[model samples]
Target chain A: MFDWLQHFADWLIFTVFNIDAGTKLGTALNFFVYDTIKIMILLFVIVFIMGIVNTYFPIEQLKNYLNKKKLYGLEYVFSAIFGAITPFCSCSSVPLFIGFVQGGIPLGVTFSFLITSPLVNEVAIAMFLGMFGLKATLIYAFSGILLGTIGGWLLGKMNLEPLLSDWVKEILKLKMQQTSYQKEQQTFYQRLPEITRAATDIVKGVLLYVIIGIAIGAIMHGYVPENFFNQYLGGGQWWTVPLAVILAVPMYANAAGIVPVIQVFVAKGVPLGTAIAFMMATVGLSIPEATLLKKVMSLKLITLFFAVVTICIIISGYVFNLLL
Target chain B: MSKVIKVLGTGCPKCKAMTQVVTDVISKHNIDATVEKVEDIIEIMKYNVMTTPALLVDDTICIKGRVPSQDEVFTFLSNNE
Candidate 1:
């Protein structure tokens, strides 16, 4: 599918630059150019479609339905599915999280949503498809959903209601009925401009990370020995999954920024599971997100949330290693 | 009576942009509406909005989940009256 891109990168590097394609510099620059453009194109197209889908999606209606139903244990899965589709910025998570809780959804269900929202989305899926392949992306998407469900269900079982901040506790005590808003009717043409602008904004937001990530990927691709990572991360060592997750927890980068690096890791013999664990940890758990959650949760609740998610991600890493 | 325009968001970039556009519309078109940024989570929840950057004119939600252009804001304000 991207054969033309590969040829273009070859022509640009070998003919235009007059460099030996066999050289490390030539190889690295070629990779850098091809991947950055490819990922950017994929990102724009996917985000544009997602923007339109988001505009038409009946989130208010869905929330009302979820509120009315007693989904038994399925609410956790429903929340994870909902989280996967909703194009929410982490910065707005607090309001969204609080809103979900106020609507009488279980804390665990909301937690399931929160856990999966950032980890699996259209953008991440597109990158995975472009970089890895269909099989890996499918595995990633499934694991992300399962991780959210199991983690949230476990958290829900903990009876952590007391861990909510007083403000949220007070709100919970009110038991206010959920309010419904009227849905606006608009033709697709009427909504095109807004959707286009949103798509452009998303592309602009992640362009830099894509460049940096691809650059590092290029460097690793050209200079690093193919067997370099095998010694450490190659085999399915029991400790590597947890180690990767732990190392990634302190750092935060969007999927676009991390996927390229992971691509290189897998190429250089890093186990797929370990690399995926690293990518999920980097994007899913962040200090900033923790700080944001602190506004509504006590220290204990926040810690518990992070710990549960971390352990779940580690398990996912192992599952990927075993399956793939 | 002045129309009450409440912009509900938790200060995300889109929310801020929504506030800016609404403010610009009120000044450029001289719409008689007061703009309030509902940043508090508790207050935002009261509106039953699932997404931020929601525009409420006289407590009627005109937009949610996306920023409206200046012209859209103008139309929303004028139509509300």
Candidate 2:
């Protein structure tokens, strides 16, 4: 479908710079052109659709659904899935967490949403498809959801709700007072322009990341040695996984924002598993997010959440390296 | 015309900060302005502000993607006026 764009890039590089197709410069230019257009188009379309769909899917339902869970294992599963589709960031995750707790959702189930939402979302999936292909993306999505479910289930058994902050308890008391709050009926007419605005806003925000990521990836594809990172960061080295998680914890970037960096890392021969671990760590367990959660959660629960998720990611990284 | 200041977000912390900044600016300046907080995801999209905590003064996007301090809000309202 994008063959014409690829050809245009090739011809431009050859004609303008007199560089042949086989040369390193030509290859880099080719990669940059092809990927830039591909990822941007995919980002706009996917984010637009997601925006429209998100408009229709009221968040109140999520709170209500988790609150009324009668199914045995399905609540955790569904919460993880819901976490993936929600169009908010780590910033929104806190209030959503408080909302869930106040709505009577289990703390474990809430944890499941908090962990998975930032790690694997629609933007991440689209970017991965443009950069890494389907298999790696599936691995990321699978591990993210699984970690949330298993982690939440285990934490549920521990029953850590007593550790919630006093402010949250007061909020629950107020929610009890407002027991008969009315729900608004949604209409398609009301959602149409809002959807377009969302699409435009998202596209504007991430376009630069896509460009920068593809640019660096292309440059790395042409210039970087194939074996540059093989000795230390490669899949063959088991410690690289944990090492990546540790390094990534302090960095702050959403999945979309960090793709270009991930592209450069992977292209320089960083193992896919190690690279994914880094990405998850940057998005899911960053310092700011932990600080925000501290507003409502005790230090012990926050520590446990971080420790459990970090361990899960490090383990998944090792498993992927071994399998792939 | 009373200036309309809309803070675009889903009521997150950053959004609250933006809202507070606008409120303080308005009261501090004694300006005739209406401050509205748009928490609905779709309503936020209407302004085409990607990051939450976007501030709009009379339909012009003045600040976005981060929280603005009271001084910044003061400057924005002054400029709009």
Compute each candidate's TM-score over C-alphas: 0.94, 0.78
Candidate 2 docking quality: incorrect, acceptable, medium or high = incorrect
Worst 10 residues of 2 chain A by lDDT: A177-186
Interface RMSD, every prediction, one decimal place: 2.1, 12.9
Clashing pairs counted in every model: 0, 1
Instruction: Provide the overall lDDT of each model, using Cα atoms, as 2-decimal numbers.
Output: 0.84, 0.74
List, residue by residue over A25-44, the lDDT tens digit for candidate 1.
99999999899888988888
**Which pairs of residues collide in model 1?**
none
Question: Could you tell me how far off, in angstroms, the CA of residue A79 lies in candidate 1 after the best superposition?
Answer: 1.6
Q: Which ten residues in a row have the lowest lDDT in candidate 1 chain A?
A: A177-186
DockQ of 1: 0.55
List candidate 1 stretches off by more than 4 Å. Answer: A175-182
